[model samples]
Target: MTIGKGLLFSLLISLVVQGCHSVVFKQSFDKQKWNDKEDWDYPQRNNVVDDLVKNHRLKGLNYKQLINLLGIPQGQSEDSAGIYYQIVMDFGNDIDPVYTKNLLIGFNKDSIVNSITINEWKKP
Candidate 1:
């Protein structure tokens, strides 16, 4: 065989091997991440919020009760009268698009929740 032909053949083999290696590595890495308990595990903290929404009911729940249940608001906002607690949750897949649910629990002078608004809620 000619040296040039051998070199070209060797280059093609190397490319093919490298491509196969890349695919294998990607699959294994993704598999490891998927199998990992920490990655797949739902946040225990979120269950408390879930329980509130599922069991306790959102609209009737008071401000102090929510604070006690969910630990604390990630952040807070205030208007002319009183403050509001932000209940933010993430729900989406890896590619194409990501989504979230943001609930605003507003309070009046007595600290009872005056309104519960599902702001930017995407889930059905």
Candidate 2:
């Protein structure tokens, strides 16, 4: 094979390999700013949660294990069946945002995660 053709083939292979990998953007959480509506600017929080769940196996994780992995949740509530931890994400414009995403992790009586629910809302 000619040097030029070989180089082109190598470049094409590299591009294809790179395209196969999923790109995940890392997001940093601030406890103090978590509740601040003006400061809540994480558009990629859903992606972060998705990646964490995929990598950490959150389904069977216990309450303590979840806390250890994800730190304290933004808010939490208890019910007859289990406790719910709320992870919220806000994205879009300041005047009229696109949508808000909420990830609810439910822990059963044994304190082991049993359900993962994602809810999204769009502006009216």
Candidate 3:
């Protein structure tokens, strides 16, 4: 191939690869912002969930302590024996959206936190 043609092809490939990549910016968890109102409406939880799980030692905290730090969880959606804090709920025209995300905190029998996880639910 000609020099010019090779350079153009390489540039096109580079641009295509870069454009295909998805960029995600993770934020630090802020108590004031998270518990400002309610979790179901707060969409920033997805960005800060990593920071909360990584930076903070949530495990071993009792129910009261967990509540004090994270506030009330989704009592109705308490499935699989874990407290769920909604991170993102895509509400479209319909009553229920196909996509959902949450931060799930699982506790042991003693009411002490044992696991903290990010749970995503996608339409089947």
Candidate 4:
């Protein structure tokens, strides 16, 4: 291959690979940012979700501590499995919600956190 043509091919291949996956920056968990609403901001929970769920970080925290860290949850998970913090809600163009994502925190009988998961629900 000619030098110029080889360079072009490599650039094309790099661009294609980069385009295949979306880049999501994982932010450090910030309690204040998680609840800041005055500036019309959201998605803070979604950003820090990776940090919270990684390494079973929330496993030993009690319900009260969880509340202290995350504030009051948006609501309990369906089937009463766990409490959840609303991470993101996508409405798109239509009025009804098209998808919803939440941080579901499950607890044991002693009210200590047992599981933490990112629950994503999408409309059919």
TM-score attained by model 2: 0.52
How does residue 95 of candidate 2 score in lDDT? 65
Q: For residues 76-105, could you state the per-residue lDDT of candidate 3 as single tens digits?
A: 346667788877787666688778888888
Error of model 3, residue 72, in angstroms? 0.6
**What shift in Å separates residue 68 of candidate 3 from its native position after superposition?**
0.9
Write candidate 4's Cα lDDT for 1-124 as tens digits: 6999999999999998898665657887788867755332365767777876773367889999888887988788786868988888878898888988888889888999988878898999
**lDDT against true structure, model 3:** 0.80
Superposition error at 1 for model 3 (Å): 20
- The per-prediction CA RMSD against the true structure, in angstroms, equals 13.3, 7.5, 4.3, 3.8
> lDDT order of candidates, best first?
3, 4, 2, 1
- Please name the candidate that would achieve the greatest TM-score relative to the true structure: 4
Q: Candidate 2, which segments miss by more than 4 Å at Cα?
A: 1-38, 77-98
The best-first sequence of candidates by TM-score reads 4, 3, 2, 1
lDDT for each residue of candidate 2 in 1-124, tens digit (9 for 90 to 100): 6999999999999998898675554545433333333354433454466655555577888988877766566566444443433445434557655665666788777889998777676777
lDDT on C-alpha atoms for all candidate structures: 0.49, 0.62, 0.80, 0.79
TM, every model? 0.38, 0.52, 0.72, 0.74
Q: Candidate 1, 22: how far from true, in Å?
A: 27
Candidate 4: stretches off by over 4 Å: 1-22, 38-41
Off by over 4 Å in 1: 1-51, 57-62, 78-99, 121-124
